[model samples]
Target: MVPSSHFNHIRDNTDLKLELKIPELNSQFARNSHNIPPYAQNKPPKPPNLALKISMAAKTTEAPSLSFPRDIFAALSPSPFLLAHLSPQTPSTPSIRPNGRAPSEFRKPTIHRGSLTHCSGSAVVRLGDTAVVCGVRGEILLAADIPNPPSAPPQPAATDASDADADDEDDSAELSQLSLLVPNIELATGSTPTHLPGSPPSTLAQSLTARLRALLLSTRLIRARDLRILHRAPPPPDAAATPDVPPTEEAKAYWTLYIDTLFISLDGNAFDAAWAAVVVALRDTRLPRAWWDDDVEAILCSDVPAEARALRLRGLPVAASFAVFAPGGGVGDSAFRDGQEERAWVLSDPDAFEEALCPEVVTVTVDCTGGERRVRRIEKSGGSTVGRELMKGVVQRAEERWKDWLEVFGVGNS
Candidate 1:
């Protein structure tokens, strides 16, 4: 029998204890009794090894198949053809791009000047599938006959000085005249599927009109003074109408221009097409000669071809629009540690399909008059913010386009 001294150390240890008593075995179990021994009883087990447990736990997760560096793994994956297929379509890449033009190239326009003979001036401009027609009509209005004529304010009441200033403000507001350069835009059913016949002008039409008017006035594309019509005042009741009488000083009259723009078809770049049409139409406009009649005390106008004069325009404003496409937010997987931020591609003069893919758009207008280029306006829409370098590039491209347009119109920039 084994001696008890073998387990003497276990007695002093609190974590282990040995059973002092052994049970007598019956005859049937006596042979196997020696095989069993009373070991430490009711003893708490030792804590597991923390480091080994952690190592075993980590093996539970699945690891990536590619053992190569993230950068190399991403580079080897996704062939060029697959990448092109996966990426959004653009104008530059021939594989997915609908049009064959380069990223920065604009579609050539077909312009027809003076297409409407009965109108004072008219033009039709087509950029790609988009087309716009513009017409201008001029009419002379007497100072008193003009709507919202400017008049002197009445004397202020003697009671309060502040009230005088308030009265003057009110008078100024009342005397404001309607703008002479009136622009109206209409998008008919032929332009698009959404534009219905007999429906009120769509919000887009109103917005275009307002935008064009603002740009015209703010950029000084047409000088207001050039539209003035001057005629001598009628002679007094006693004054005689003699050939020797000196010409009386002329009273100033204003010309009211009705600029109407209509969209025939729209694929994209509606603003650019409409603005170009307006520019060409105004260039074709002519005004009739007007003279005062002392006998009748009225203004007379003649429709004789020789008596007409072309309306002088100040500058040419050319607009270029761009559609920007960028990848949405995403983080690189373990296979691609050097992840890219949002990537953007700027496309000039995109067609309808390309424009539909991009939510952000930028429109830049440049005045290329007097042989100098100046940015007249920059309009942006959507959530993205265009970088300054991109804006500069857009302006530069617009200047080049302006030159091309000038050549088409046979107009000099002097």
Candidate 2:
């Protein structure tokens, strides 16, 4: 069973105080303590140079050429992603709260491993509101199929073009086939406060999938060569000369491993949660060996074990999201951390509800590799802003958020 998740924040008032006030935390780092720097000699004779302070204030009093959003969906607008999902009060569409933050941070996460006890390895992973499960089974890959024996190969030279065309058509038909029978998502009947029946993949889901796929593929987490298995179509019992063994049905036949993901909970950024869950489960996966001995020959199914290989990945992709605050609420300096009031959720994480209330938003994907990290892409959303400086803070905060996630995951600084 996976960890059932609920979205929450460091909501306790004391936590908020600690988060908001640190540098001035005279108690946490008292000067009199032995931990103090050696420069402090117990002597007290230093006084501020009032003349120098005045000169600096006079030189730099202009309210920093503030940079903020200019349009509804531009660098100054609120989070476009937030406006896409619905709230508990309104299931039909998403709504923003005045104070921001839905009082929850992340939905519950559920992880089930080895769902198919009969199969070599399998897993069903659900991440708080966003769910996904994947299974791995053993199978002997059969050699490439051979074309039916030709009766009489002599086609006229005049029909050469027709033969070429026939081959092209067959290849094209095979290429267009879509057989991804695995349901990529599953929802806990209770993800949302209400049920959204008959709803196809929502725009948010589709967008998230694209981003997730991009991240997974770009990183090369699982190589195609590694996943390949020798697939064999056993001869059927109907044939007297060759033993005939009927192939299994879609659900039963053919080793089909599934990763069922349900979005019982809907937050602004379900993609990140889903990706994290998948990564964790994959790291924990192991395939058992399958050996078969017939009347004549012995067959061995290849098993992908951690001891034999390391999961090859291009790199880890991290997403950083931001929210815009209205004029009445609080806005922080994303660029400079020296401001006392800037501690408002700008340079840190924000829950789903907090995101909706903000007007302008930005999301960034970062890749950590080669002893360094770099920005892969920057998605700028539209929304109007109260001032120009707010936009600047958004960009700065986006970078900081990326750094924070890296540190949290112990992936190292970008």
Candidate closest to the true structure, highest lDDT: 1
Residue 368's lDDT within candidate 2 is 55
Residue 132, model 2: lDDT of 52
How many backbone overlaps does candidate 2 show?
67
- Top TM-score prediction, candidate number: 1
Candidate 1: list runs displaced more than 4 Å: 1-96, 147-176, 233-252, 329-341
| Candidate 1: tens digits of C-alpha lDDT, residues 1-414 | 868875775665533322222233345367665676545333577777999889878986758574765446435542222234335467663534446566778999889999988778999999988999999988777765755555433222224564334422322122125467889999867788778899998998999998888777766666444454545455676567564554444444667788999898998888999999999999999888876666786668896988887866666788888987554411222232246454566778977755655678898888878877888898998746568887788788889988878887887887
Candidate 2: tens digits of C-alpha lDDT, residues 1-414: 544342224346667788779857766667657776656656775766999889888889867675544344333434332332222346664343333434223233455655655534445544333445444333443222213311222222224575344422322111112111122544445565444666676666566656655555444454332332322334466667644533321111112223334464655456555665455445444534433334434445455654333333335565656555433342332333343233223322344545555545566666655545566666556554424575455545445554544554454442
- lDDT at 305, model 1: 83
